[model samples]
Target: MNAWLDDWDGNIARTKGVCWIAGWDGDAMGLNQAGPSIRCGSLGEWNPDERMTRLVLIGTDIDENRVSDTLDRCLVRADEEGTSWNPERGPFPRR
Candidate 1:
């Protein structure tokens, strides 16, 4: 999670007209390019662990498939033991 944020911050200058909403363990962070405002809060009072991340991006001239592919690579895959696992390294492509 920390690594993802770091990469986003590092490349923020190159992004435009987009919004990102990420949730983890019931907590969520929101950022919009319109005003570049950042907001964070629990999804609800009765927070429960979903153990998943959700991101929503809206903008012009963006390739939906590419964005989907990029985010898909960050997801955890099921191992032989039936446990979800993320890669040791971040999946975001390097600039």
Candidate 2:
């Protein structure tokens, strides 16, 4: 699919819920800034914003679905399936 700008009130810094997952096998969705939640202080360092870098994990990976479900709980959406996601806009809009 092509890149889209859904105009989400200028939130470039993607928090947990605001991020989407794009992987090799048809990209999963709802993967927060920290992919698949890990234990506290376990997900090692990475070069955020600059590029996508993998963090060093000390423990077994958490269930990605659990993380996705958790994100769903926090997300505020008008859609029922929680499929509606808004991307950031470019160059700002005119009032």
Task: Tell me, by TM-score, which candidate is best.
Answer: 1
Judged by whole-model lDDT over C-alpha atoms, candidate 1 comes out at 0.38
lDDT score for residue 8 of model 1: 45
Cα TM-score per model: 0.38, 0.22
Per-residue lDDT tens digits for candidate 1, residues 14-95, read 3322222232323333323322433333333222444334555545566667666765655545552334322233232222
- Residue 30 of model 2, lDDT score: 26
* lDDT top scorer: 1
Worst 10 residues of 1 by lDDT: 16-25
What's the lDDT for all of these models?
0.38, 0.29
Against the true structure, candidate 1 reaches a TM-score of: 0.38
Tens digits of per-residue lDDT for model 2 on 1-95? 11122221122233232122222112222223333321111123223453332322122444556544544554344563434332232221111
lDDT for position 41 in model 2: 19
TM-score of 2: 0.22
Q: Which runs of model 1 end up more than 4 angstroms from their true locations?
A: 1-54, 80-95
